[model samples]
Target: MSRPRCERCLRAQDHCLCPLIPHLQSRTRVVVLQHPSERLHALNTARLATLGLVNAELRVGEVFADLDQLLATPGYRPVLLFPGEQAQALVGYAQEGCELPFMLIVPDGTWRKARKLLYLNPLLGELPRVTLGQVLPSRYRLRKAPEAGALSTLEAVVQGLNVLEAPGCFDQLLRPFEALIEGQIRAMGRETFERNHGGR
Candidate 1:
């Protein structure tokens, strides 16, 4: 039988990561659009992000209803954090568009699933878009990246917040992410995880 899951963190009881997360607040709100399939995936990271950030929320759906409401919310500019040639560099936006804080709308799923979200919800396609820049290598050892620039949901949030919210946001957010990775590594054993994650 499967181990009992923690009601809060939603992981196995022993692997509960809720207590490790730091409470981070920012003027900018984070909205994660997660596909239903990824809601319970063992390695999903978006849920953990919402746990720590005061202004963050996770919405599970194939097509969203509040695309209009969220974008229209006063005092916040909703922008999609999907990378593309048309996606303005996030740093450029944070610097130039200093008039208002951002509401980062991120899609959490496989590349195909994320694309499906954009297709299903045409309103999302109309939002201003932003992309991360000069990122270090991804530390998501649990899954193979679909492409070179891809990042886990939590990592993307950290990167975006660090650029748009404040400095050190990356380090604060990274604590929980690194803790989760280390816990999984310990569970899998160093030798097996190293072999699987490209170490000798």
Candidate 2:
């Protein structure tokens, strides 16, 4: 049999829906530290996040080797987006008078890889960790997470921007993810409305 079609965007073999990706500009930048394993996966949300946000950057590697170089980038604050009681909640930075340029760093991979990234990267360990307080469900249907509220890369970016009170940017960055997922769902003859949510 031929290769299986994408359940979300029913493109034929080699004609994936990822090419139609869109990006949005925001005051805050999004940096996706993706695992090499997720680079080609159809269900990887880092691709979706990069497609959705113009300012988003995707780095595929096991560790952030150039951590200092990334930190030296002009006009950008870096915050790791992860959920944990021990993590430094993001509410502190949401206030005014904070730095103008900042990056929301998200590790894209399985829980094990994500934990490894966090543990191995000394620079990342130095930065403040942010967690989402809202208890909701994930939108990534193809993948499974241990936690019910685990969000995809796209959803995490949207929520992070919203926490920064940048709705326009959030909506802008979210559109392409929405479109791509919807396109895929429609291509598979699935209900578009059902998969409109951010997490599966």
lDDT of candidates 1 onward, in order = 0.83, 0.70
State, as a TM-score between 0 and 1, how close model 1 is to the true structure: 0.91
Q: Lowest summed-lDDT stretch of 10 residues in model 1?
A: 165-174
lDDT of 2 by residue, 1-200 (tens): 77877554344446565555564677788889988888776566677677666677888888778888987688877777886767754543446568665688898888888888888787887777778767356555545567777777778777777767543445555555565566567676565445653234
Clash pairs, candidate 1, are none
lDDT of 1 by residue, 93-172 (tens): 45666778888899999889999999999988988888887775788876777788678989888887877765446556
Model 2 CA deviation exceeding 4 Å by range: 1-15, 18-20, 92-94, 175-200
How many Å off is the CA of 51 in candidate 1? 0.9
Q: What is the lDDT of residue 63 in candidate 1?
A: 85
